[model samples]
Target: MELRFIEINNLVLHEYTEKIRFQKLITKIEEEGVQKSPIIVTKIDNYYLVLDGAHRYTCLKALKYKYILCQIINSEEYYIDTWQHTISKDDYANHIQILLKNERFSKLDSEKDKDILQINTMNDENTPEPLESYIQFVDCLNKCNSFKRVHKNEYSKDSVKVIYPEVDEELIKLLVNKNRRIPAGISKVNLKCGRILGVSIPLQILNENTFHDIYIDKIMNNIRKYEETIYLYEGMIL
Candidate 1:
């Protein structure tokens, strides 16, 4: 539950970012003039690897902010899951033809294969790197007619589902260490407790010039303001 403003350069991403979403976030944050929540991270050795809010981290970096607020969680306090991507039938039909013969993936031939594109089977030196292959796969889907992430598939006639493998902290650290990243919006991290949200911190005070005094003052003020604001909610977050 520790929250503090750390230098942006000290933060590292575990996944590749989507450029279109990154650009949109930059515009949205500029218009709002306040960040709704701090990006979540876990300390790993010398770097704080981002667990969530990849786009937010990149947006602040793009805006030339030297330090960004982060919600620091213990590395062992969270688990990771994978998002299931769905694409239009038309796009799937078109791409499946190309993928069926692709070397990097295997066709979903059995019921045990999980009914999704098997994209993690790079076996030899000649094969494209795992990160590069994943980026290419998602980029093609992005250019398609329709794409979305779904929690449950409706078994619709027009939708094609793609389930990817879930990642763990070990693999995440390996990727960061090698300067590689998976496609964004796939690694879903579930934390043990409630996250700090809706703080609405002003963007103007996050600059380098104000990092020493004004930033700390505002953070303390916000902490005092929300010290007694906690409440219990029993409902599901979906």
Candidate 2:
């Protein structure tokens, strides 16, 4: 129960028994970036133990993070076994612009206004939902498989020029990486921890033109789904 600044790399961990998957984490990693949660300490002595954070440790190891926040505790006294543990997912993202672009927000007098101002105004009957459009984009991106050009699925999404052209390959990959590939059954839920923007991006531009509703809807849906899922699945759902 003590808070100590231990060298994250120094801690020794028990065999990672928890089934931590990468696709499950890709959503938060992309939106929140990295540094989502503190490492779990399961086996601790005068120096170290395996508490949690098996997946996070792996991610840091893969990303080569030099330092991390680890739980400092004793393994002998409170020797309890659990399937999964919950952690924070608040990503301290400095570049909020990536999440909240200038067009995503607007100043109505003084207070900031989110909620896109109806991207599709003219349609008397069939204007697509903004959230739905964002979802479609996520679907399309999943089809691309991150633009790595794999065999068997070599076709490109050039037809989606209106919403997502070839230039937005990276953004598409990010969306798919976040939501589409998540697997179930997790014990700990960690929120992304990093700098965050003061406000959300203005997204009226997505509504300003013809098919912007679909574009904005898809992106927002991914972000919303990501945040909600992170909040809900931090402990048991995985």
TM-scores, all candidates, are: 0.68, 0.31
Backbone clash count for every predicted candidate, in the order shown: 0, 49
Error of 1 at 72 (Å): 0.6
lDDT of each residue in 1-238, candidate 1, tens digit only: 6778888999999877888988888998999998767889999899998888888999988888877888889967788988876777678777654755667655454234344543343333464454444545555655664667677644444566766644777667657776767666777899875576666767866775455455546655666334454776645586
Q: Which whole-number lDDT from 0 to 100 does residue 10 have in model 2? A: 63
lDDT agreement with native, every candidate: 0.70, 0.34
Error of 1 at 134 (Å): 7.6
Which candidate tops lDDT? 1
Per-residue CA lDDT of candidate 2, range 27-87, in tens?
4544655454345553322435434556666555555545544444443433332122111
